[model samples]
Target: MNERQRARRPGGRSARVGAEVHQAVTDLISERGYGNFTVGEVAARAGVADSSIYRRWGSLANLLTDVALTRLNARSPMPDTGSLAGDLRTYAANVAREITGPDGLAVVRLAVALSSMGQQGVQARDDLLAERTRQLQSMLDRARERGEHAPDAFAVLDHIMAPMYIRVLLGIGPLTPEYVDGLVDRLL
Candidate 1:
């Protein structure tokens, strides 16, 4: 296996290290821009030796990418609420909770900054988008099966999620249940 894959093998560093280090990285990135942070600083804050982090993530950029993406995926899977509007409201509420929380807000800020940097940041941005889209798609699939949704499933799903994220990225407002319900109504 390739080195990266080998390092991610079960019981390898990936399996042993819990979310603590990731949380620390998120905090540091939020307080100090990713461009200003160093792995040594992250290691010290996370209470791990620098070598420990280096062995797992290789570089600050890679570490940041993994930290942001991993945390987003760590949220609970979207709920199946039986109706498209109901399911999307639940999904939106869940996302709103996460994105407005301290860790989630920090991760979103870092992601927005990274995304604005163009090609250099495209892969990580794309990976985060794809992962979140997959989660939203699962909810959309359930809605479609229940006959609560119309055609253009992808657009419908995007219409609900994209605005929530845009607000988070722009610091326009907190994602509230009221907002989630509003978006669901418009999308449905």
Candidate 2:
């Protein structure tokens, strides 16, 4: 197989059992919702000793964090559309498509449900939000550099792009090309 596949069963003393355990937990989460899950169950599912999981992740929350973020936090490389509207629409559609998928929906649901109690929760949410905002901001900055957008247009940028999440969460509309075209027309 490839290098990533090879890494699946790393050959050394420090090879991670965490990887296998996390995959098992991911499968279980797909089978069973996060709320109705347990560490013992994950251990059983992973076929690894419970201590191995605890040793790697320290707690269920940590394990779930790794499972959720590691799987869903892969941001694709941004495309250079040569114009603000084209780039933003492409980016938004790409992100919406990715995040609205089965795994992405699962991660969002899990994050919303659990990321609120402690330091880890706050950090996790902050990290996600910051990453998202940074992506949008980078696109906006690039657009400005190419003279496709106004230099001081953060407000307009937010106004146009903020609805992406609303569409996903409220299920108010499809993220269709026609819809993206409309958004581009209004914002750009």
Candidate 3:
């Protein structure tokens, strides 16, 4: 096998290091909140050299963006249950669990905090939102193709997702199954 093939292999040292670094960021954010630590601190927590993070992710904003996006993608996969209503409920429930999971709030906070760190931070936030919108659009498009009545992706964000996120962000309430389903039902 060539060097590129070996590098592309799953569970390689690179992947392990990347995962460790991401976890370190999450832990730090959970413990001390965003902007409370530095890249060096993250490296120490991950047992990696600070230069490695710089080499891989370029900047702290970039690294934070990567962590947020990676966690979001890894957790909330777009659901497809044929009916648009079913898909929205399932997707919202998946998201509810994700945000309420052990590291979910930390990752969510990381994404929120990224918005105020100046140009790079704002750009990262935009990238994260764009990725989410693109994923939702795919599901909505599938519904449209099937001749089902589907609301706009932004509507899903506004009606279903934004409420859940705000509830999680503000510690307003628990995301019960009924609540998630209700959001979907109201949207439908």
Candidate 4:
């Protein structure tokens, strides 16, 4: 193959492997949870070698982290509505749908279970949470620029997101649109 062909080939192969591995990780976690699966299992399921997974992700924890991060990012896009309330409502509704969905719920459970394993696991959990917070902060900054109630980004994120996450995590209440609307109403 020519040089350009080689370069393009690697990109396609790398993307395919990454997608396969990610799907494998999620499927294994969904089937047996995080604590019970092995990297070998993931490799076999993904149709890639174990060494390839290790070379790409370094460890199972890292792989799981990548899976969670990728899935979350793909599912939860930052909202860009014209108003703060509109933005918050859209964001909250998206989050509610994700957390309540099967894939999202599975990832959340796997992430929580993986956190106690070691530093890698803990870092994965922290990283995912940080990314979520960062997205929220960005939305808040946009709202602030639009002359909305501009509280500290972190503080406002905590106030708005904490209860929604808590309700989902604890199974206390449903993350309904009405509930999210009320939260946005109270916040804005």
Sorted on lDDT, highest at the top, how do the candidates line up?
A: 3, 4, 1, 2
lDDT of 2 at 1: 69
| Reference-based TM-score of each model | 0.72, 0.64, 0.84, 0.83
Model 1: ten consecutive residues of lowest lDDT: 148-157
- Give each prediction's root-mean-square deviation over alpha carbons: 3.6, 5.7, 3.1, 3.9
Per-residue alpha-carbon lDDT of candidate 1 for residues 35-100, written as tens digits (9 for 90 to 100): 677778888888888987777776566677787767666674567767766666766777788877
Clashes (candidate 2): 0
lDDT of candidate 4 over 102-165, digit per residue (tens): 6546655766777776887887677767887788788888988888885565665676677777
- After superposing candidate 3, which stretches have Cα over 4 Å from the reference? 1-10, 101-104
On TM-score, the stronger of 2 and 3 is 3
Q: Tell me the spans in candidate 2 whose CA falls farther than 4 Å from its real position.
A: 1-19, 47-66, 73-77, 99-104, 144-162
Measured by TM-score, how close is model 3 to the native structure?
0.84
Q: Which scores higher on TM-score, 1 or 3?
A: 3
Comparing 1 with 3 on lDDT, the higher-scoring candidate is 3
* Rank ordering of all candidates by TM-score, starting from the highest: 3, 4, 1, 2
Q: For candidate 2, report its TM-score.
A: 0.64
List ranges where model 1 is wrong by over 4 Å.
12-14, 18-20, 43-59, 116-120, 150-158, 165-176
Summarize candidate 2's per-residue lDDT along 83-147 as a digit string, tens digits.
Answer: 87677667666766775666546656777655644775566556655665576677778877776
Clashing pairs in 2: none
